[model samples]
Target chain A: MYGNSQFDGSAAFSGGGFMPSQAIPTADPSSPAKSREAQGLLPLTVKQIREVFQASDDKANFLIDGVSVNNVKLVGLLFEKTERVTDVSFVLDDGTGRIDCHRWVQESLDTKEMELLSNGTYIKVHGHLKGFQGVKQLVVYSVRRITDYNEIPNHVAECIYVHCYNTRTRKMQDAPQATGQLPNPAVNTPSKGYQPTSSNHSQFSVQPIVDGMKGIDKIVLNYIEQPSCIGKENGIHRAELAKQLNVPEHKIMEAISSLESEGLIYATVDEFHFKSTVNG
Target chain B: MDTSNPAAFVNAELLRMYVGRRVRAVIQVLRNDGGSIFGKSTDEQELVVKGHPPNPPTTFVEVIGIADSNRSIQAEIWTNFGDNFDVSSYNTICQLANGDFKHLFI
Candidate 1:
């Protein structure tokens, strides 16, 4: 009964709202995003997140644009504010709504990335929702400040496009069951601007920092520069690079440190977010 | 960034990001109801009152209150950029004094 709808990663890009764009050269057969899509952990937009908060019943799990999800991915402004309780929280404005993101500090883990975030910045956040004293909040998994302001509009458009795609797919899936007719293969085909999984608005304004690099480092640089815009709020995390490149996290970190020292790449938004000097 | 306590997006930045330092906004006047001219954000997320603000559209405004429902924010005009104000586009930000915007929504 669940054969067609088993969600065994066939719709990897569909669920996460991420398409395997040429921008992200995760050419490796075993990629983290692919695995996550197989696992069905899709991303949610901030506006959809607001709907999650509003539609929740006694802190219940909510659906984001027809997909039942607990995780969310949002892009927005990071405003600087004083520490209210000495606890680390980042307030984000994605134009649709304002959300507070919380990430617990692990003493054993490196928090240099967290320290890199500052106010008056644009950023991308990945995490889930939680309730604090009746107010809805986000418990973030990752946060990066943005450099390319262009990604702002692009991100918004992506959220809308993905939501529409998912909604259409679900409706198509449901129709077959309702009518007992064979599912239409054409229904799963790409929508307008859905080819190659690249965003319609991702024409990059910057280039990769490749002045001096070799082997994996060059490949990593190429991958990080995949996003149409790159800078403080628009750079890639070392871990993200690792997943996309199918490389070890340590390797990406090492490459990043070297590139940073050469002054070839710098943090346009904060320490964690990087942009090539050539782009500036 | 401490994630344990989530509260980094503060009120001050909201004014700047959503509104602006100069409080520049393209306010859509809904109607002029005698005493106070009613206006709102192009998205209708905010309710604005013209002439209620003292300064022209160039300076700053005070965030007075937000509705209990959290649907809107309320502020009194502190200043304006100029006496004459008009918004040409919906998304285009009309440069107003930071004080003219009372309550800012998304």
Candidate 2:
């Protein structure tokens, strides 16, 4: 049994994932799909739309009516004077609630169809409710021109959907498979003297060196400026240098450990410095 | 970049000792978990050896190959410790030229 729900519009799906069957709302018995041609023109107010459907607790399909549209924005088509197939959607704000109005124009709708529905054109849409990934929407069947300028307070003609696809099926075209063989890594070899700095190593070096160390290059320069008798004499004591640099002692210790391991620096007792030519 | 090439990591000083001699060697990478040895004909390829999480001391690696006209075999050991190890670490060792292998443990 469904309990009392707080959702204002017809109860619809609530989570996100594509479930096509649950998306489409059933048409009202009086407004049969077959009678679309005879019921060609029906004048209805926004309030009447709200009275017809009750919000459901189900997670599949729901209806949204009497919602105010908002955030009407536009995107441009590439070729000038050429109308391309596009899909548009807008946010429907109903003061108490909000939902997205999604429109899907099939690829089959050619340039001619786009010409008929130019940008900034206001049209009344007759559609059934559909839900996708728990979001309630109106899957428009047919749209007619609405001469009333007041209906569409905001008009933006923008193509929001872009896809690489086959013209007929609208399915994505397959991209060329990567050669299947690994690329020759030789070409990507690093230049000589170029040393990679690790994020952890740099973080360790910077934070412990200077208060709020902004530039890593500056810290490395500072370290280089203070020759620690790395190669010529006993290396600088890591703990002593860390204190002088005003950096976290632990970070400096870690950096010293890594540098010593990498042969870039040498350690003697508690001191660390650049490796001597003889030792290096 | 191509650490898989055995010649790239071979000590240049050791290589000069042989000059134009062809030496065959098997580079093996031993995992910390006693996993299978990663054997390769050339040191050109990179071998990724992972460390157990939670509390890992460090991961060990070695580049082994023949040098001095196959008269002598050489191995360079290195340690890497962190959350995500760099692929360059493997390549860096492979590109060491002429430098003493002991220099790595400065």
Candidate 3:
């Protein structure tokens, strides 16, 4: 291996099964071709992993929470109760559950980083999901050490957003199609301020509140429709909105702004306090 | 971390990981070439083995050897010689795409 001494750790990978390719070097099993798919990756708890085991039709293809998982990613703390193999085997726990993660080779062993990978340390695992003998395990591609504890909660929140966005979009498309009309009839029209969709027009009949609205806007309308938020008389506060959807305050403000401009939600007491037109 | 370098391709590192470890992976023997047997993974990547194991594709094979790259592996395959592969160790190969978009799951 005629190479620079700076890449000393790189040699460890080539020792057993690999011979440094004079032709072309394939870095790790993770390839560039797969990354083009931007949608559908989920961050899951151990309890949710059981769904993948039941959902996978075969070992090669699998789904988690009805979303087709090309590669399953998860964040969790290391659990050390499991048996160890040379350069393989890591059991992870994210409080909701625990699962085994295996690597084909040992990358960082007998090092401070390996020591730091002890029980209870948070790690972000990007890997392929595998099921063996009715149990699921992750055939890890790469494992990153998580420095910040907040990343754990953020990871879960992002997964919820992605899943919610996908499902809501699917539901929106389905609602229009149920009326036996062309889907997305609003394509050609510019809203002169909250135009009711032609397909939904007959369905809503007397109620304009069931008009053509985006997912988050519809959810906000529903939130105001709730007794607790509406019972406040002044309406739900801004801080409560940011907390409920688990989004930033600014994002909630944006949605609220659009809803107000569309004449859907109206301010009651202050800018943050809002009541939907239908709820009133 | 370096994406420009072809050597930094993820499959290359994967080859290094599988070396010497006995993995029960699902493999399809595309063709057997006398002393050398060539196979295909479920991910549709090429798998080359220097030694012979069994006939038929889409079956389980017990493999232990070295990985030259993610696509090219030199495995001493142990076939189940039955309709199914091994229960405990068959490698169920899958190509994963990470959210960061930086990870290349081949």
- Quick one: best lDDT, which candidate? 3
Give the TM-score of candidate 2 (chain A): 0.24
Which TM-score values does chain B get in all models?
A: 0.29, 0.23, 0.47
Question: For residues A1-280, what per-residue lDDT tens digits would candidate 2 score against the true structure?
Answer: 3577576443344221333343332443542321221211222222222332434555332221211111122211111122224654543321112334455666565333434654333355544444345444554444444443222211110000100001111221122210011111122321111121222122222222233233433453356334454334655565556667777777776665554443334545545543321222
Instruction: Give the per-residue Cα lDDT of candidate 3 at A144.
Output: 74
DockQ, 0 to 1 scale, candidate 2: 0.01
Candidate achieving higher lDDT, 1 or 2: 1
Question: For model 3, how does the per-residue alpha-carbon lDDT over A1-280 read when each residue is reduced to its tens digit?
Answer: 5575475575665433331121121332443222222122356555556545354344545544344454557776676624345555778754345678876555554233345566655689877666677767887656778754345435655554444444444455555322121111122221321333343442232133345566777667677767677567788887888898787888788889877765666898777799755432
What's the DockQ for every one of the candidates? 0.06, 0.01, 0.01
TM-score leader: 1
lDDT digits (tens) for residues A168-249 of candidate 1: 5555445321111111122232121111112212212111124235677677666655545354466666666777789998
Q: TM-score each candidate.
A: 0.37, 0.20, 0.35
Q: CA shift at A263, candidate 2, in angstroms?
A: 97
Best DockQ goes to which candidate? Answer: 1
lDDT of 3: 0.50
Candidate 2: residue A48 Cα off by (Å):
6.3
- Please give the clash total of every predicted structure, in order: 33, 22, 19
Q: Candidate 1 vs candidate 2: which has greater TM-score?
A: 1
TM-score of chain A of each: 0.45, 0.24, 0.46
